[model samples]
Target chain A: MINLKHTKMKNELIKPQGLVKNANRRQFLRMGTMTVAGAGLLLIGCNNDDDMVPAMPGMVSLGTGDIGILNYAYALEQLEAAFYAEVIKGSYFANASAEEKTIMGDLEKHERAHREFFKAALGTNAIGALEVDFSSIDFSSRTSVLGAAKTFEDLGVAAYNGAGQFLESADLLLIAGKIVSVEARHAAAIRDLINPGSADFAGDDIIDSNGLERTLNFTQVLTAASTYVKTEIDFSQLPS
Target chain B: MNLIKLLDTICPDTKSAEDRDRFYSRRDAFRQFGDFGKKVALAAVPLSILNSIPHVAKADTASLIGVLNYALTLEHLEYRYYQMGLDSGVIEAPDRVIFQKIRDHELAHVRFLQEVIGNVLNGTPVAEPGFDFTAGGNFTPFSDYPTFLALSQAFEDTGVRAYKGQAANVKESDVVLTAALSIHSVEARHASMVRRLRTKKGLDTVKGWITNGSIGSLPAATTAIYAGEENLSHGGVNVANLTGIDAAAVSEGWDEPLDMNQVLGIASLFLAN
Candidate 1:
C-alpha cells in the first residue's frame, strides 16, 4: 500500500496552494458576486429563452444539460476526495484501531477513485479541481472526523439521487449510480464507527418512513457544501 | 396460438417460474388491446406490433412499470428473508438491531413501490412471490447466524446492483428515477453494515465495500453475487492504476451493476417455484 502520510506531504507541496492561501479574501468577494448573480437569475427566469450565458471570470459554471449534471457530480466528488485525504493524515486516524484505520484508509482511496473517474470521463468539459476549506473540522478528535465524514457521505448520496433525473444520458446516469452507492456505503461505515451496531447507520434523519434516502436539490446541496469549498460554483444551468 | 409458444417467441430466456409469471403479465397486457386482440393469433403477435399500434405513450408507461415491478420483486425477497431471520431467533442483540432496521427498510421499500405502482402510476403492482431462503435446502440462513449474515450481505449487495441496472430504464420518469436512486443508496448502506458485522465476527478479509469480488468465507452460491464486482474500468477510464491506492481499493471504490437477466437468475435461486 502507498504510504498515505507520504502522499499527503507530497500533495501539499505540488498541489495548488495559491488559491487556498487567499480563500478568506476571495470568499468575501465571491459572496458579494453570488448575491448579485442570484438576482440576475431571477430576472433571467422571467424570460422564455434558456440560452447559455457566456462564461464569466472568477466563477465556474457547471455547464448546461447532461454536462451540467456531470460537472455537478464532479464538484461533489472533488470535495469528498479532498476531505478524506485530510482525514487519513489526521492524528485521530493515525492512532485509531485497525478496523477504523482500514475504513478510513479505504474511504480515501474510494473517494479518490470517484474523483479521478469523473475528471477522466469529463475530460475537457470537466470542471477544474475544486479548492476545499475544511478548517472547521478538528481532525485530532475521532468524533469530529467521523461526524464530518457522515455529513459528506449523506450529502453525496442525496445529491446524486436528486441529480439523476436531470441527466439526459442513460450512460452518465449509470455512472452516477455506480458511484452513489459507494458513497452510501462510506456513509454507513463512518456512522457505525461512531455508534457501533446502532440504527444510526441508516438513521431516520436521512432515511424516511418509506425506506427511501433523502434527495437534495442542487441549490440545497451547494449551499451546504459552500462552507467547506472555497471555489464559487455557478450552477445556473442545473435545475433547482 | 398457445400461450407457452407465444411466450417463448417473446422472451427466449423464459426458463424459470418467475419468467413464466412475467410472460403471463405480458399476456394480460396484450389482451388489453381489444381490437387487435380479436384479429391476431397470440403466437403471431409480432414484437414490432408495438411500433404499428398507436400505443407509444402506453408502451412507455408499461416499460416504467416493468422496471418498478422488477425492483419491488427484489425488495420483497429481501424483506421476507430478514423478517424470517428475525423471527427465527438467529439474530441476537447488537446484531439484532441491525437486522431489524434492515427489515423495516425493506418493508418500507415494498410498501412505497406498491403505492407508486397502484396509486401514482395507475398500474397493477407485482405480487410478492413466495421465497425459500434455504435456496432449495442448500443452506439454513434462519438457523445459522453466519449463514444468515452471509445471505444478508449477498441480498443487500444484489439489491444495490439490481437498482443500478434499472436506473436507465426509469430515466424517462424523473420522479420514479429519483425514488429509485434514493432506495439504491440505502441498500448500499445495508450491505456495508452487514459486511462489517461479518468482519467483526472473524471474517477478517471482508470490508464494507467489496474487494476484488472476495467472498471471504461466504458459501460458493454467493460467488455469483460478487462476480463482475472486480471491474476496474468506469466510463472508459481504467481506474485500477489511476489512484495511488492499491488496485483492490480502486475496485472497492465503485460498485458494479447487474442487468435484469443476471439479477433475475440470482433471484431465481430463492424463488419458491
Candidate 2:
C-alpha cells in the first residue's frame, strides 16, 4: 500500500515545517503565495493586512473542485516564473557560469509559458496575478538561486503527483502528467547545476526506496508555500 | 452498485459513463490468452463487485501485463540506449557521469517492470532485441556529439509522450498506474538533462521542456515522437484565446502523449528487428 500521510517535504520552498495528518482551516492560512515581479505575481482578490480571518483579507481562495487545483498550479507557476525572471534581471548573476546562465535563462521562458498556459486554460476562472514575496531568497548567489529553482522544480513535480488522485477528468490528468514530467526534467537540470558529477538529481529527499517520487496534498503544499506568498489561499475546495 | 461506480468512491476519479463500452471491448480482446484472458474479462466488466477492490490478484494478472510489457519494451530500449552511449566512448568526460546515472535509472526501471510482470506471468517474457542507433545507416549518432545529442533528445522526449499517452489505460490498476507515473517523471528528468547538455555544448538553443514541436524540427526518421505535440489546443479549447498568451508558447507549455503504436513505431527505428 502506498502510505500517504500528508507528508510535508522539507526544502527551501517554504520555511518551518510541522507535520499534520490533514490540513484544516488553521493549516490553510499558513500557506502563502510566492512572488516574482513582472510576468510572475498575479493577485486575485482583496488584501487587508489588519483583518485576520481564516479566508484572510486580501487572500485568494483557490476556489473548490478542479478549478481550484488549476488555480493552485497557476499560482506556483507564477512564483517560479517571477523568481527566474528576477534572477536574470540583475547583472545576469556574476557568479553563474556562462552555461548556467543560458540554461537558467531558458528555464525562465518555460516557467513563464506554464504560468500563461494555466492562465489561458483557466480563462475566466484563472486567479489574479499572484504576488510572491522573495525576501527570503538571495538573488545574487548561484547557490541561493539554484537552490530556489531546485525546490520549485521538485515541489512542482511532487505537487502534480499529489494532486493526480484528486483529479476527476482524464483530459486534465493527461495534461497534468505531461507538465509534471517536464517539471521533473527541470528539477534534474537544476539539481545537476547545484551539485554536478553526481546522480543526486533524483536524490533520496524526493524519491523513496521504491523509486517513486514523494507527493504532497493541498494542505501540505499550502503550509510550506505560504511563507513566500503575500496572498492567502483558501483551500476549502480541496481535500482537507 | 457496480464495481466501477463503487470504484469511483475510493478512486474519486472516474472518466465519463460513456467510456464504459470502450472498457468492455478492451477487456474482451484479452480473452484469447487462456486463464489470463478470463481474469481480464471479468476485471473489465463493471456490472458487479464481490468486494470493493475486487481481486487484487486478478487485477494485476492479465491485461496489466500488456501495459507493463509496453512499458518494459520502452525501458529496455532506453536502458540499452544509454548503455551503448557509455560503451561508445564518445561522451565527453564531464557528461560521462550524467549518462552513467541515467543508465542506472533506466536499468532499474527495466528490472522493476520485469520483476512485476514476471511475477504475474510466472516467468520472464523475453530478452531485449538488438538495436541500431544509426537507423539503417541513415546517420551517424555515435561518432558526432551533435548527432548524439539530437537522438538523445528524441528518445527522452518520446519517453515523456509515450508515458502520457498510455496513462488512461494504465489508470485502471492503481499499483501499475502509480509505478508507471513514477517512471514517467524520471523519464522527464532524463529528457531535461539531455536538453541542458545540448545547450551547454552549443548544439542546440532550446527550452528545458519540449516546445511547439521539440525545440526545433527533428529529422523525418525521428519526427514521429513529436507529431501531435505542436497543437496549441487543450481539448477543444485554443490556449491563446483562453490566456491571451502567444499560441506557440501555449502549445509549448503542455507536452502531449503518443499512443502505443506511435511509440512502437519510433522505438522500432532503433530496434534491429
TM-score of each: 0.79, 0.72
- Encode model 2's per-residue lDDT on B131-160: one tens digit a residue: 888888986877876787788888888888
TM-score of chain A in every predicted structure: 0.77, 0.75
Error (Å) of candidate 1 at residue B177 is 0.5
Each candidate's fnat: 0.88, 0.48
Instruction: Flag clash pairs in model 1.
Output: none
After the best TM-score superposition of candidate 1, give how far the Cα of residue B220 lies from its true spot, in angstroms.
Answer: 0.8
lDDT per residue as tens, model 1, A1-240: 111111111124123444454335445555544322211111112221232333345456676676667778889989998998998888999999988998888888888888887776665566677778899999999999999999999999999988888877787788889889999998999899889889899999998877889888776788788888877676655653
User: Candidate 2: lDDT of B205?
Assistant: 73
Candidate 1 wrongly placed segments (more than 4 Å):
A1-57, B1-57
